[model samples]
Target chain A: MSNLEQIAKLSGFSKATVSRVLNQSRHVSQPTRDKILAIMEELDYVPNGNAISLSKGQTMQIGMVTEGINEVMLPFLNSFVETASQYGYQTIIYTSSGDPKKELQAFEDMRRKRVDALVISTCVNDLALLGSYCKYGPIVSWQRMENPQIASVAMNQYDGYTLGLEHVISRGRTRIANAYGRPSSINTLGRIEAYEDAARRHGLAELPQWSRTGIHSIRQGEELVREMLAVEDPLQRPDAVLCSNDLVAAGIVSEARRRRLRVPEDLAVVGFDNTELAHTLGITSIYNPIADQAKNAFHLLLAKLGGACEPQQKLQYCLVQRATT
Target chain B: MSNLEQIAKLSGFSKATVSRVLNQSRHVSQPTRDKILAIMEELDYVPNGNAISLSKGQTMQIGMVTEGINEVMLPFLNSFVETASQYGYQTIIYTSSGDPKKELQAFEDMRRKRVDALVISTCVNDLALLGSYCKYGPIVSWQRMENPQIASVAMNQYDGYTLGLEHVISRGRTRIANAYGRPSSINTLGRIEAYEDAARRHGLAELPQWSRTGIHSIRQGEELVREMLAVEDPLQRPDAVLCSNDLVAAGIVSEARRRRLRVPEDLAVVGFDNTELAHTLGITSIYNPIADQAKNAFHLLLAKLGGACEPQQKLQYCLVQRATT
Candidate 1:
């Protein structure tokens, strides 16, 4: 006889009664169920419950590994959580601030905790570590990685920047510069590539001094613009500036205004994200469809975990024209 | 004989090996473990493993129920998750958009899943429903509630607004108006009370047209400011506009600037949140101590869960004066 049968007989209960208690059914009397649970607890009979549950399939749990703090983090997480809830799945969130060591630990913990899948939202340079974690479960990345094993939802940041730059160039401005966070980040690198392409296409000379990188805050934007404006050379001045975000663009606008330069007419500016601030300030911006990206990422992960291997997705972005451009 | 004896005897091995396999111990050989697991699976012996595990204690899981989308959600979640991780706990998030039924479901789900604790970040008017869930686990709220049973990390929004409004009044601006989110929300109500107190104390006649309600976006700010400026009565015109957030202030600033009105000189504007945009645009605003609130909320919840009773906490906010005011 099996261990379950032994427990049933020892408890003086039928196998169905024991099973009902195990399943946490409400039909069983409280005292009888409590006595059975006490006996089972004493025996230490269910130590491998999590593993057994995983083998039985469908924990209804999705793991999300994110950097946890970003402009996109809350919106993406909101969309993902709502969408996951619609599919009767609960989401477990882990944030490591892009730390690979912590990310590995998160993967290990998620595996031990028996999550069905993982969505990696943070920008990670380490591909091997991410690939190794695939052994634990289905892994989906927010960025488009060309890897066949890992699925991705790619953001069309390159084309978006290209379009923004083209808009600036078409408006008869030749001297252009870009400032953004972390030149090493993949998105920034893509933007840089697009910036170079636009400069080359428009026959605008790329000023080494004009290309400002490692700019993260509005204060940085003010400092950078002031530094550029302090340039004594007239020919070296950028006629137009493309900022990493609305805040940076706002800083540039304020500083330029302080110098009595009219926006668009004197120093044209374009910002990214098309945030509420961008719209309010009438800033030309690139709109990354955060909600769409979130939905697609969740669906792709869900489909993969549900036995259908969905292809990697690439979402589109739009350039919104406003007063600044 | 018990099921343990039956399984051990049936496998021609000792109960210790059987127990090791059930515990997922690496000490047992792969083949032995696999054979024992197969037999257990066939017999449906591990069905009550989850219940047994719960009784054994410490699932290391904490459930967070939020409204999912808010300016504060991402930043708050970042702090909560990091703090939870420090305590060796994993967070499962549920967002119901303030739906009480779904929140009730979340509580039930958390209880059924055997989560050790719960954190409620969503705003709910009903205290009775929340009180009912206290039996499931230790519960902590993110808002200031009068319930002695529920510990909260309260935000001093009332005093924060009073301080902001008083600053505007001190700057010799008589025609003061307020703009904010849903009037029904507790935060906005507090702000309204402060607005009234400021207007009454300063002996400024309340202009019906000056008070704008249900303003949520930058566009709304622009529209409302435009509407205010269009008012024919000179006595009703607001000289200063206090916005719900930096985004709104940006909108008011942009609209005012569009009509050649100099900020602070002609029209004073103050925004709340002191977000990056506010700094970039040089808007005077109130800074909500997000990180401090997050830390305190986590510590409050942690203390309650750790069997140490912590009193309800109220974090302070400060007004940051910049160029716009």
Candidate 2:
């Protein structure tokens, strides 16, 4: 049978009634609606939702901005996109590459694309440039500092670092070294403060030589370890090393092995952001609760979209101890 | 001066001309254009690119589909998004979660959103569902089998495995153990075939008892290693183990350590997909060029979008020998 004949016979309705239901031009009786729905389902008819939405002047799409994609943030990005998909909103991802100009451009592009909302995890320190874009739509920042102008979902970095330091102190490590991320970043700064404060509270002087700052990469960790090992005095060598993240800590452990030093026995190591690498390496580290952070970021963005008041959301962190400490 | 007055005075042109140039409405002379550009640059004016694009009926958005986000694929995702941004396109990512249903859904959503192009690294074996989406715009698959109906870019997995397996065989290990991925996966199947063929060619019978299949996770690796060690006789146990990926290799090492087995001394271990974990663990593994694969996928997608002839792009892989093997 032809398509129209099949629809009419299946619905037990006239062609005019079927057409009206198909086009939604007029209201139909409940019995007629039920019959038409069953017929459509039986025929495996797939309606084009986009076409209907377009006819009604609506498009569902969102934008997500992130820092340089790498192991550090891949899981989070994946989760965010998947969750956004559940809400019938498509997500556009922009990589800022830790550049301010690129971040500004990304926001501008999202605005141009007319995305309903945006989730940003860029590296720019200031939020002033993002004000105009935020005004255009709901803007949410993830795993970063709280912005008064935009809702933010961030992990408690200070507490996470403190927990790591406290774990090391619990292990009776007196002299400690730290391989931290860039000091310019707010998250890194929080870690540095926590380290100093925790050390001072434990009755140890925070030595300047024991701290090194660099990008969060294995090569940086290896370089920092080499620098530390080059110190001639035995007393100058730290008994433990704390890394900004698990990846860096793994690098430090590898470098130590190359230098013929043993882990936990010769020098205890601790890291932050308990990523999969840390779990595999059996390194003691802080769990940053990335999945929770992503969920909170989504909710915060949703709230802003619903015209709710914007508030800073800080997720909790925990210490996960392994053989390294 | 106010914004309008500043634009009029700085360009030394009529207000209408400045407005036209800002809106990109009418063709202005080159000298006038240069003067207006300089004036805008001097005034620190940031043009609303999105607003201008809207007037021109351009969306400037693209979509990407991939398996669950993890550390291994993060670098590639970052680079793809960064490059897309350079080309004035915003990218939306969809996670397939290795489910064919979700992969199909992501394609449908991308089509509904009218994405300019799509880049997918799906886990599904068939491309029939993807064919329908390709009709609307370009759809590029990454690290998957290619179909004449869809464009694809993938690594030379067979060659990479052969290289690593040959290295292990050359080391005089006859009893080889293999930790493979799911048998249903094409990539894993290729690696398994290469390994079995290499063994047969070397005059060794492929032992079913020496092979294990599981997902790519550290826990799986550890479990597989334990099962291998549980063999009744130590002499009958395999002398070497080849892992499907780095995470699995790390798990094997951890399990070996738990069983008081020294790597390369008691049982040599090798891994595929030389990720950062492999480097830090000093495990000999195959290096799959993720960046190049991503770049090639983007180029192929662009070509398909431009209605160019579709070509299957296969990238090369290498084997890096480290201390483990």
List candidate 2 stretches off by more than 4 Å.
A1-59, A307-315, B1-58, B307-314
* Leading candidate by DockQ: 2
What's the true lDDT of residue A138 in model 2? 77
How far out, in Å, is residue A158 in model 2? Answer: 1.9
TM-score between model 1 and native? 0.81
Q: Tens digit of lDDT per residue, candidate 1, span A141-221?
A: 776565677777767578888988999899998988888666666678888899888878778888777887877556776
Each model's RMSD to truth, in Å?
A: 7.0, 6.0
lDDT of 2 by residue, A196-243 (tens): 899889998787787878758987777777887788885678888888
Candidate 2 falls in which docking quality class?
Answer: acceptable
* Interface DockQ per candidate: 0.33, 0.39
Segments of candidate 1 deviating more than 4 angstroms = A1-56, A259-261, A307-314, B1-56, B259-262, B307-314
Q: Kindly report the docking quality category of candidate 1.
A: acceptable
Q: Model 1, residue B145: displacement in angstroms?
A: 2.1
Worst 10 residues of 2 chain A by lDDT: A49-58
